[model samples]
Target: MSPDLPCIVFVRSFLHKPDNIDHTEHHVRQETPKQIDGHTHRRKHSSDSEKTLTVEDWATSRENPHNWPLAKRVITSLVVYIYTFVVYSGSSMFITAVPLVMQELHLSEQRAMLGLSIYVLGYGVGPLLWGPLSEIPRIGRSVVYFGTFVAFILVTIGAADVSNYSAFIFLRFMQGLFGSPCLANGGASMHDLYPESQFPYTLALWVAAAYCGPALGPLLTNSLVNNISWKWTMWLLACMSGPVCILLFLLPETYAPTIRYRSNAFNTSHNQNNNNTSSQDDNPLAKLKFYLVKPVQITLQDPAILFANIYTSFIYGTYYTFFDAFPIGYPPVYNVSTTTLSLFYLSVLVGCLLAVAAYFTYLSLPNYLRKHHDNTSPKSTPTHTPPTKHERHLIPAIPATFLVPISLFLYGWTLRPSIHWIVSIIGVTMYASAVFIILQCLSMYIPSIYPEYAASLFAANDFCRSTLAAGAVHFGIPLYKNLGMARGSSVLGGVSGLGVLGLLGIYYFGERLRAKSRFVERLVE
Candidate 1:
């Protein structure tokens, strides 16, 4: 087959049903060799040579993951969250050892921080590779999870055993690269496994893990490092990886096209006429090119994608910026022990819990008001609708937009030695709460807006977030060191203040922005 034919065929299939397309007959295609016995491969050939197959339905289809039993869906979601938690912990676990690694390896400050800086750089770059591969019909999401989990486990163990600084840096980078698939595509998996109505609550939990893991990582590492050794941090993380690998294998594939292609009742004339496999099977480079280009295209083309990315990037960058800002106030003026400082991080966790509480509380208001207003009309049970474009707007997070800067101001101003340490911690907790609210809101809105390309949309968001945060960390530490904590944090707060405009822009004009974009328009349809 010609190189362009694969692209053309894919576009045609995507835009129309297989039966409607003149050139292709729809029948079950055994795209994956390792089928799940009766669950995956159920095909019946027609009396005539012609074949017919249809896409899975949203409600009735057994092949639809949304149609799975509630208990099974919950178990799958738990496994995905565990996978997310383990992988994200690897990113920040080394943070506590930054000082120790420098001392033990006889390294300079810049060189020592490279272990994290390079690892974060890998986080941004790795997904550009993983996001595309995860979408391949032949490979799918679970295969990517399985492969990356193994690589992550081995590299993490290598991190514990590294004899030299260069080896440490390389291994850390590899660990970040291998561990990034969940961060990039975990939301897409949630979209695959659950219907839209259930996504908000599900995302709240998953995103909490994503944020909480990085906050929790330093605490785990701090305890281990202070008591035993810094190297134990990597070993413990490797041990955690063992269970995640088991969980990864247990969850079956949920990517839709992959499922449809593997389903016993589905097939295509493209498979029979050309006798050629997926482009990923034939031209691996071309497949790679398609995957790599899609994220870039989405990032550039969609205004909503671009601004949502920028907003989330700044929020994430602020989260890392606080990593530096927190130490300056706590370790010096408060003179807290490493263990005590680690526990203070829990204030951020408390803030996240409060954010979750606020989310549910705010969510409940709409339901209550809607029911109260409609009570007089009839006693008929209400039916559910998929969230509309306006309903998915970031309006609910509007309260958070103002709160982040205000909390930042309070956190910065109250960090003086004259002030009580708990006062400053409280201020920072407010910052954490506001940030969590904003980040969680974007997490839900972006994926819901572009459900078809949710993984790539998330990949773009992660790319912006990780890259910006990694780049800013070098300057962040210096800012806190050169300027005093109060002044330094005020500067950080000022930057966060700018993000308010981004939130307001999307809130007011997001629908118009989405309407203007071809990619989002197509995806919405």
Candidate 2:
């Protein structure tokens, strides 16, 4: 072992060690370049395999909101309704502020009213954007809820701080733009929470909440306007918004496609490890493209959806017109203060409460009993199927449809100063009740008709209702002025009569229309 010999031994040991160069080179020498490349590829493949992960539903997974506990679904639904209540309340709360707004801003009555009308128009158009984003499996309901909710609050605050009428109008419009997701996506969220069987009842409560919010809004803001500045009314909205924003964050994602996407179970691509790159659009523009095109396509192609949009739009227009009509009739005839006038809006709320009660007793209980009976009945076949997959609950929408015309006529005739005010209020209540019933039926039925695209279907309905309501809000006041409450409301009543015919047309022919469309399918089993 001379020193040179020792150096040689150290070099051989370093180079030829089994864990280092020796075994690697031996394999390198044993194979051609292609074979060596193949061997290297196999090693790389084995390394990649360990990094790959699979997503599957476990037994009793909570990924599906339908499987969430009753408490979670109920709380979440209540939060969503509260969010809607705030949005709609914001829409009408400023009605009391219109006179103050005109006075302070030195604007005309028409321009002052545009604040509210434009806000509603924004709501109509907002769904054109938010509706599609929400349906994206990547974006989902929770994100829309949180994002829109925060935007609503900020816009409401901006509305309070704006000094100019134009800025005020812009902010109000932006407020509606941001606030509309709750209205547009709410029914779809309810659909996520419950199975098809439970949607009608839940949707009825939801629509009731939404209507009642607008009714209650004038009541709250009347005090704010009378006691505080009109700016405070906007501030009141901002204050109310804070808590809803918090709750929206707490809500679990209820959009099914989104949940499936997150769980990786929904994407059918073989390489989900690519982070759903193949299944979902990485570009915002691509997502927007689908969002914009699909709902319009659905609305244009589907007769049932188009009819529902038109039917609800008429009802919505009439409802907004009442905001002006009630104020006009009572202030001049009864000489009521704005605050007292706001109380008259309660007629609609009373009607809503009664309709809700009637629904629970007449529709909900019977449907539940029928369901239980069918499920337990010996007549149920060996397959244990329930009797019918179609929503027999919609049977009520038909008879209730006629009430709109009757109530409208009654509301018109009873509004004269010669008549007692309570009599007129009763007429309004009847109209409200009928409208509630028709709307609940439509909301529930439309979603059932297009379960796969419930959000888009709902967005279409929202767009129709809000756009018409925006036009009505501006034109409705003049209409009452031109025709007087009696003739104006009578004209509306006659229009409502047309709605009854439309409803009848839908009731008899709706199924045939739905069956022809490929975009939608029957909801139930």
Candidate 3:
């Protein structure tokens, strides 16, 4: 019952700590301090009844995710990856079925495309709700992941059965809404299991799965769509998601606060006492409001984050635009069936794999080795000065930025029937690699600038990108139709070139902008 008990100290530390403080750095004394003769002294060999638990004890305990054996960690991370992949696949699986739906439902291409766009929009909105709910200790992450996915399965089933277009669109939106937690929180789950030093490696793998999911969607369901009813796409989603839902039950809660609160060391009386002393902001409704409002506020106020969101959003939109753009470019020129065209997406997957390798080789490996050397070397040993935190993230991104415009131009011009399809595939591959690098770099760099608001900023980033991509799905078809493939892609490439200038400006002036931010100023104070 004592406030000074080690378990109580750990609880209080977690409750009041900033959002981004590294969990691995937390340490608590193993012994209780006693006041004796007007001096504080450590009590040695305290009785079992008098002993208390500490963060240090928990850190080493089997319950700690960081202490989980390598196999358990890998399995857990893979489950999360599959869960994320399934959700993202749901967004694009319906793309191949668009023609069938358009013909059967008596709809325009734009109206049919709404099914996909609305789903993207749904996930964009869903994160504002899910991200905050998952942060609460009582709610935890596993509950959100499992519960939302069950809802996703039901919605997918409903979408498969619905004959009416309106009902179909609504169901698709629900699928995205229900399937969204993994997209936003999956990386957070990985962060719970891995130390900061190993996070980038795990993150790269997760991102690859995420990018590949949408790229593979058409390929996975192409035969189904071609051989059977278009409804098979939704059925395929249901089949894939149902088993993953069951597997999710095996995923233990990874959020530290939730695990700590559930432990025997956290007594009910202590919890009640802490709740009694908590501020109004600790209440559920206030917490929800803070989560919803804070992200928007931060996005608008921070110049670096605001522009980063714009640049990334445009890049994200461009990626989705290809879903529509590809059909236009490949079919007329190559005279291929839907199945063969779907095979072109393999190039995107190839690009994703290459990007992950490039990231680890050029960025992750060198930095890790440098850190390892610094830690092991003699104090007097000379070592090269390492890149600053922001610099490390920005370095690869600069070259990747240039690749985007160049890839776009190549892909645009190379779509001619005279040019071999492989040439255009190479361009798409280059664009995918560049996109992966830029997104991964900015994802890390922006959060580093304001760790306190990292979660909110991520939600903001997701919202921006998803909304733009939804629009891009609709815009891409018309742009290609009116301006023709070569001209349309050139327009996009020109815009991306402008984005390069914007990104370069951020690289140079981001620190100065951060210094001027009210949010950054408050954090410093």
Candidate 4:
């Protein structure tokens, strides 16, 4: 009942178990309506309870999200990976074939880009619903994700079947709306499958999966279009969603709190059987309904919650918008085709790998600091410095804060239509490295600060970033045509340089800002 009880309840829940807990026995549950995170809740050994309770298997654990017995966690990750591929294929896969769509629909270049825009719009809005929906029991995340994606497939079919251009865009928007959950919920799945210590690395691999879809999207869709037709792109994606839907039934519920609540129910009921109570109670059904109906409210309604999310969104989303400028701003100026363009995306993958190195490099900091402290300590006693945010697990997005613009300037000026594609590729490689670093930072930062609502917080950010990226795509081509490629790219480069500066200012001021935020301050304390 005390204000601090949520934290206490959550900690106790993680460190201990419900075998040692019961509905009639819990002081906290009686007074506080909120349940602790199930993942954090550990079932302790006790004479009364025989249930071998663990949210995840102890052997594979976080060491390998990929290493799960192919049947359980790995299958879930792969199926979710398939969902990601479908969602992104709806975006980038349509890109090369935009001319085909425009020809059929009688739309202009800018207008045809709307399909891609609509898909991204889904990426923005889907999270608000999906993230909260995933946390609720009975109606677990996998169900919500599978159900919405099936709906998305229907919407995709509608887009394919539409005769009217206006109706087409509208249907595409609905597709995006349903598809957004994959990205928002996918991150949560990655976390559920991995541990905090392995989170950064596993996250890097997951990030690659999400982006890999975009990179590989064109290849797969191009082959599809080459053989069949562009209209079939959506059709193929819809077809793929079917198998993924089937896979969801086998996907174990990874939401920790929900897992714990169910385990408790199983135990309490079985124990009741042992006690020889012969009764059929309506209350269990009522509780099941209660669990199903519970909602997580994280709307932009609360001023404090809104500002924290929005502020984080802007700082993070700006990078996404900044990177979207890459393809049109520099590639064509260097005379790269859509087919060759996929080569450039490899940089993001490379950056993701580097980010793993950077993260482990960071994980070593505590050890390094401890050693330094030991050497410098007084003989009789030891005094140590509290790890600052900068020095602690938050590693500087290495080589990126500088690499982005340098890559930009190199590609911008040197990239003439006549120049070899390699020059621009090299430039893009740097920019990709920087962008991937930014992506890594944003991904890790969201979860690090708001571990409970990691999906929602990132969902809030996806809207900001996706919206800005869509807006930039709308205006970028026109700006470049009017202003000329070199100058246009120069202007963009200058703005991006400013973004890097913003990153610096944010990194320096970021800790202070979070320290001041009542939500985060409360969490950290």
Q: Please report the candidate that would top TM-score against the real structure.
A: 3
List the candidates ranked by lDDT, beginning with the highest. 3, 2, 1, 4
Model 4 earns a TM-score of: 0.72
lDDT of 1 by residue, 1-525 (tens): 221122211222121112112122233322221112122222324434334333232224676676788888899889999998887777777778878877887887667667767777777777778876776666678999999989999999998998887888889889889988887677767766755455567778888888778778888889888788888889999999998899898888877656755773333553463233342233445434544555577778776677778877877787777766766568888888877877788888888888888887766566556545444332323432223444344656778878877877787788777888788778778877888888777776765555445455566678888998887667777887888777777787787787777766665566566777766634313
TM-scores vs. true structure, each candidate: 0.82, 0.80, 0.86, 0.72
Tell me which residue pairs clash in candidate 4.
13-41, 14-40, 14-41, 122-176
The digit string of per-residue lDDT tens for model 3 on 1-525 reads 221223321221112221112332353322211221233323333343223334455656688787889899999999999999988888888889999988888899999999889999989888778877787666778999999888889889999998788999999888888888987787788777776567778888888888898899999998998899999999999999988999998789888667766774444543443344233313455555655676677778878788888999999999999999988889988898899988998899999999999998865455567567446533421332233446457767889999999999999999988989999899999999999999888877866666555666787788889999999999999999899888999999999998788877676666666667777623211
RMSD of each: 8.7, 16.6, 8.1, 8.3
Q: 1-525, model 2: which lDDT tens digit per residue?
A: 121111111111111111111111111110001111112201112233333223233112466666788999999999989988888888888889888887877888778888778888998888778765676566778999898888888889888998887888899999999998877677767766765456567878888888898899889888878887988879999999999999999999986556656776532332243342323333444445544555577788877677778888998888888878887788888788887899999889999999888876765455567667556634434433332333343556677778887887787778767888898888889888888887887766664555445454566677889989988987888888998878888888887787766766555556556667777553223
lDDT of 4 by residue, 1-525 (tens): 221123321222221112222112122221112233321222232343333433233222333233445467666777777777667666766765676877876888788878777677767776666655565544556777778877887888887777787887888888888888777677667666644444456556666666556655666576667567777777877787777767765677765445544554344644443233111111233223222222123333233234434433433333333234455655556555555665565554565556556655755566667567556533432332333333232245534666766776776676676776567656755665566666666566544454434444456567766776566556666766777656766776775665555554444455554556534424333
Give, for candidate 2, the lowest lDDT window spanning 10 residues.
28-37
**In model 1, how large is the Cα lDDT of residue 319?**
76
Pairs with steric clashes in candidate 1: 27-266, 27-267, 28-266, 28-267, 29-266, 42-264
Global lDDT for candidate 3?
0.76
Give the count of colliding residue pairs in each prediction. 6, 0, 0, 4
Error at 175, model 3, angstroms: 0.3
Q: Least accurate stretch of 10 residues (summed lDDT) in model 4?
A: 22-31
Candidate 1, residue 52: lDDT: 38
**Model 4 misplaced regions, further than 4 Å:** 1-71, 226-228, 265-366, 369-387, 390-393, 450-455, 522-525
Over the full model, what C-alpha lDDT does candidate 2 score relative to the true structure?
0.70
Score candidate 1 by lDDT.
0.68
